[model samples]
Target chain A: MMIDHPLPPGSTIGILGGGQLGRMTSVAASRLGLKTHIYNDTPDAPAFDVAAAATVGAYDDLDAIARFAEQVDVVTCEFENVPAAALEAAGRSACVFPPVKSFEVAQDRLTEKDFVSGLGIAVAPYAAVATLADLKGAILRVPPPALLKTRRFGYDGKGQASIHTLCEAESAWEIIGEAPAILEGMVAFEREVSVIAVRGQDGTMRFYDVVENVHRGGILDTSTVPANMAPRLAGEAQAIAGRIAEALGHVGVLTVEMFQTGGASPSLAVNEIAPRVHNSGHWTQDACLISQFENHVRAICGWPLGDVARHSDAVMTNLIGDDAGEWRQNAAEAGTALHLYGKAEARPGRKMGHITRISPKS
Target chain B: MMIDHPLPPGSTIGILGGGQLGRMTSVAASRLGLKTHIYNDTPDAPAFDVAAAATVGAYDDLDAIARFAEQVDVVTCEFENVPAAALEAAGRSACVFPPVKSFEVAQDRLTEKDFVSGLGIAVAPYAAVATLADLKGAILRVPPPALLKTRRFGYDGKGQASIHTLCEAESAWEIIGEAPAILEGMVAFEREVSVIAVRGQDGTMRFYDVVENVHRGGILDTSTVPANMAPRLAGEAQAIAGRIAEALGHVGVLTVEMFQTGGASPSLAVNEIAPRVHNSGHWTQDACLISQFENHVRAICGWPLGDVARHSDAVMTNLIGDDAGEWRQNAAEAGTALHLYGKAEARPGRKMGHITRISPKS
Candidate 1:
């Protein structure tokens, strides 16, 4: 499944998930004359509306996954939670970007912390807990004012509980369904930021400007480019992301979320990593010459990466639930680009759309 | 079939052609959470690769066109050559943009010339030639050094012949297959330029910067925004396009191509009009907040028009036939955005792709 040359314009890239990320990636692929085939279990997946072809089958269905892979020249994923067996099945038929090793580390919270720390990177103190006795030991080592989170299948503040005192460890574990978990000592920080980096098959790397993120109710609320941080600190954040990509032998787009601690001297600590296109990089769609989704397609297809420079400073706001109801107002506003995902329902906490407002750099 | 309200997300737009314009429009529709169903006579049409659904039927198939229109909330065409009967069939089932009146005026060369002149717009002097006697009479009125072109199905410099002398009139007429034609006296123009204008259902209008175009072998080679002209003349060009749009009661995007006659006082003569998204506006995809394709979707859907302001100056070069072979080199160049149409072959004179380079506005 090793591709020695770039895939031609008509080749198809098979995608593992069918959400907003997949939908945007499909549009990017079309711009480059490439075709996309989406594989998702849901019948009405948003990505299905734009992809050249689609397969509605379970991720673990090895036969179906292999067939989907066989039809495409290469394979990539929109999310990291895709099962290892499915990726393995796809690998037998087509080359997969960001390799399975990266996904393996990103899928498990404990493994990701260990991987980042192993590279001599900054990470909050953490300990693994599989039972009540292990939780007690972890609380003693990691201390209170910590978070008890499931090792896998957690997103958007889900599958997590707060332990403010040692006495709350048992209840916090029960709240997470007593799953295999990790206790992380929360870092008191001033701001949260993310670095979006892309690596080509040739090992050439490009990093977008550090993006400052604000979260409400644990979901991304807004992402602004040219983060309000010193240039030296931004460089360090990008360097850390570069080291992670190099260590994992990652190809395509990878995102690193970090916490910035404020004091007399500021510093950054690795929070987590996502092995695919991320929500925090959505502002690039309107502000930069090449978007993260387009770069992902170029990287996976073995094409040269494009310019990462921004033409204007931008702020991207997410549309959650009823927030999408204000699309008319957003559309009427000048200099605003509104993007709505074709979801039938705007259930509470669901991401329905996003809008980006750009202005000349100050 | 009149749509008084904006179509909601997840609504379908039926497109009548599946060429590059339709392909790009479909991608734009997807960005707004809208789905597209493409109808083309060919099975492997470029647009079908990205649409939610597709129907392969002839334009003359009234029943098929009606059925296709019935499945969508609105209907639009990518090319003006679509049969009037086909649009009529679609209009019976759904609201069609750029209305049939505009298409009727655009489809016939003689009709378009008379319509423009009737509206007090400058156009090349022209006479209809339906018979050999008409050509003899037209030669006296229109004079030599004129173009005798077919009234229908003429594009990209096709179906045209030049008459440089009085004796050449009959041969020129025979060269165009003796179809109903028009003989337009040639004007000594210094440059070719175009204006892309969009009109909304609410009678709002927005105009993009005038673009200077270069043609090679009768097909567009490049389009540069901020056309090299006096500010007053550019404004005049826009005003002329606005008058035409108003006269036709047009909705959606319309393009008016003009010839700039060089002299102490440079004046514009209307060359022709396209009642749809056009090639000259492609630069907006990278240089402006909203592209012509996106704005066309908004106008046809009864939504507010977007800002037409550009953040950068751009030069767009087309990749025709063998020119696409330089894609690797183009990809390596910084500050360039390359777009390919997903066509399998690179036939001579075929538009395979385009590349645009942008820089901060001067």
Candidate 2:
């Protein structure tokens, strides 16, 4: 795509979706002198408040999408799960980044796992289960204490369950609403780690320092950069991210989640990949001079990619539900960087905001 | 003073008059999830490209101002020289941060001096001059080598001339188009410094670590944090800013330019106050985790102030005109942070961008 779109400052960047990710992306894009147009199905979408233009219409609404795409210079989605049809529709006249392949792999756990495994990368022991009987057999092979996850549209503990015993088998399958699934032998890992790497349109790749991620109930809880990984391991993780990005011809930041086991544990298995920018990279906003959000904007804008150097050793903690309600306390705490998502309701288990702290790394 | 216009994330921040200050402010507001509407008289206004909605209309166009403000939730201006009527027009219905009082002071140097004086602060010995005779008389009463500056709408070595010798009077008067002016005794100063402070709507004020500033050709060239002042002196400087903010009831970041002079060097004396956010605070974006831009957003939105604590001793260097053309060298320089304002041309003397490098104080 020869994007000579003449996207100067004040131009609107039409974004598909209005979650916190989109909300934050809009924030970064706006900082670069670009206006943002958020298109999402929900009227109450969080990003609506901060955007220049917004279309509260379903992704499938042709008229709405056409008008939405017409309002901005280029279009990008906050989440990778934007339907293929919706992307094709908005991508007609607007330049969409991360390409359609991002959603293709991102939308399905099976395809994503295969894509990772196909790259000669490490992933949890996994098998595709297209039917109930196939799932049972795969479980029999993989054994109990395996994860049965829907192949499509699963996140934050939704559309998935652990098969701890046979009594929970049918119910676990039913909990996922009988969707197509991927069964995997769960890896007992010491810690979850994620590497967020950016690939510019010109084929240059840069990675933020590795972030050791902490999650609770499947949702990201915290991420500390300059993650306690050996330099070689961090380099290896970055290389894995780069390979995936280059393989997908990916533009913008790609975050790959992995499980580290071994030594004291079993070690090193790929968990999943988020083709777009990830929450795990949020610490970049405060810890690195150029944040992941800003780098994503720069990469997508056809500008020279920025340095991803970390400014300080940092820790990022997500403020979930009532945790976000403690912003006053968090804000007053010295050296802590508080970022509130501006969400009205602090619903239980919902991500409301996060805090990043920079401390001496002695 | 009530802001009935409660714009959330997706709305536009209508900026009246786009300049470098507007451009930076637009960048800051966007990072907090607000899209911008940069309305400047010229098409090439620095802030326009980064905004979503822009109107190219003369400052006096009330209809255009109304239309622009109607489309945005809040209206903020970069230049205070905007005709009071023009500002009043834009701020008629929309929320305007810092309001007209701040703009009024910035337009006239004499009034600004008096305003600061009324706040029990120090300003240089000053006198107003509506004519050349008044200018001559004011100068005789003040120091032999005093500065004669246009009372309204002067900046950056423009709209005013240096008066070194008595013979330069007619030319100085003519060069400024014989505008209403002010004459002040030039204070012998050890250093030029500024305090960038933000006052929240709730009456709290937050000041960044006082910055030591260096200017070349009347343009800000470098700013270093921990301005190396005695801790008490730094506290005194911040107190001055707080008093000014409280007096103006200012609701955004205000950059107070001051002269540090006296005894071998007298310490600091107030020079001028910028009603809007200032360039001197640019280092806050990278050195301080919460940034001046975010603070501006918080102050204007009636949100709580953020931590302005510096993580490291920080240095900011301006990329003026062709200076910004050295993007490659700056980008390649390790540990030196680069920031490009996305300006297309690097015209001579034009401020294009800046760089910041934060090092710990030994």
Candidate 3:
């Protein structure tokens, strides 16, 4: 069916990838009287537990993607790495949010950095390394104390290697299987923060408060809202995110991670951008009036964006793996909201759940 | 498979209804990493959209109820009117919250009043009126400006009639289709309010702040938290609800609607009790640290009750029928949280959704 903007209640939203993000987005859609049809390669995807419908198929299966898309008014993704071909297939049957351009730019490290820097946003100095010859030359420009990240299919510190010096570059590249990579020179940053922003179909944009994020083992450990930064710096981060969204003509929630140098005068450099909801924005679920997941559903559905104001300061801690076993204690704690993805196993480093502790803003 | 107290994440909660309450409760269950299997009589029940599994069967279908219960670790009802036999069937396979006693008491108005009044709690003076002769005699004891309501299967102001005077008693009784009914004398009250309270499996109780309610066309129009009452009176209301919950040895959330008489010394009279999550408590979803639905899930799962502290003041307005059409306007309003049940049609008097507008506490 041909659907109009601001898809009415009862309209189905086709979601690609059925992980915790999709689970949350499904819940948000349900809250708005909308239904979600989740498409994932795995049968026991986390989001399937909350969606109205589910389709299990390979991401590159164009027929399956088209069939899934045909049943919904619009399509969106829980993860940024959705195959371009899958999104293209979905686009033939349903409107897709964040647009194909946004995903294309985000799928590669070099392209993402180039896109953001092209918008006049500050980014860490970086150079592409496609071969051993390229690596030798690129290291001179983007030197040691840097990261060699594969251009695609990298997440949670995987497909990445650290290069501490010129001599270690080759071994570091070998560690990542010598994949085409981007060499990003490390910045002397004291804090890492992210801006969770959303753009509506009408070009309206809303930004949640910048959140300070800490990563442990390359997975988001905790995110504290109202990042301990000057308001001016936070606003600048939001402005940079807005510029990126505008340049991409993006719709739905877009999260931009940044590195902040600490001192009397701190400067921010765009680290990366997630074309979907980011783990760092999970704190909004408990601290703000509207959460990133809800806003994403709103934006993708072509509805008006909600107020993204925080009511309290919050620290959201991920319960990776066995940490979820302490749920009883977390449940008993006052002022803590515990959320767990219904994953049956607690594999090491897997995000089993999260808890957000909120206190009145100072 | 046996389940222990403080049911672990991934446990299935079987809900016995599939309306908006069930939908929201299912979402809450999902947030805690719990799955929900909803059993409802209709195919298009709203809760099915969010549930992990759903069984379409009559409420009194013992076989179906048992089958659904067997797959779940625990059972709970979204509405109090669930048949006693259904609970019995479910109880055979899984633990049922609020217990059959709670449902039995709440099913009949006379039994409910007697049960509450027996605990030294003030309830509206009421009398059983099974026939015209009974109505005549009961009206003499309870008097006019009273309500003649069916003893069972009454909800949203249905199965009720108002008796303005002695002569209107017969007509009022006829209005209720002469079902086994009760005659309740109206209290001279300044406001209507309700206390949403939850009792854990261990008998621990937590009460949300009393909320003032207003009805239009016999349907809940709005519920304002921190009801305009003295703290003392609010405490009294909560204490009264606690007493009822304790008396019933209730588990999960129980709501008590009350009539508060105005004067130098305000007094509260129990209007009725709902043995499940209630509509008036919808504000908690937006304004409180933990909502009634989440607490209900926590309580029934044999987990510790969450903090019931309000972070902001809120007014929750029900979107009865056509009111949901203005979702765009509500969505655009700042500080407002709109929740729409995925109902396909907005028939008059049908609860389509609700919007909760919150503000910093005074």
- What fraction of the reference interface contacts is present in each model, in order? 0.75, 0.13, 0.98
Residues B157-238 of candidate 1: C-alpha lDDT, one tens digit per residue: 8999999988997788789999999999998888999999999988789999999999888899999998999999999999
- Model 3 iRMS (Å) reads 0.5
Question: In candidate 3 chain A, what residue range of length 10 has the lowest lDDT sum?
Answer: A1-10
lDDT of 3 by residue, A75-148 (tens): 99999999999988999978999899999999999999999888788899999989988888888988788999
* RMSD of each predicted structure: 1.2, 4.2, 1.4
Which candidate has the highest lDDT of all?
A: 1
Model 1 Cα lDDT, one tens digit per residue, A1-362? 55799998899999999999999999999999999999999998999988899999999999999999999999999999999999999999899987999999999999999999999999988999999899999999999899999999999999999999999987998999999999999989989999999999999999999999999998999999889999999999999999999999999999999999967699899999999889999999899889999999999999999999999999999999999988878988999999999898999999999999999965
DockQ of 3: 0.94
| Docking class of predicted structure 2 | acceptable
Error of 2 at A143 (Å): 1.1
Worst 10 residues of 2 chain B by lDDT: B2-11
Provide TM-scores for the models.
Answer: 0.98, 0.86, 0.98
Q: What's the number of clashes in each of the models?
A: 0, 23, 0
Worst-scoring 10-residue span by lDDT in model 1 chain A:
A1-10
lDDT of each: 0.93, 0.79, 0.92
Query: For candidate 2, what is the total of clashing residue pairs?
Result: 23
lDDT of 3 at B276: 91
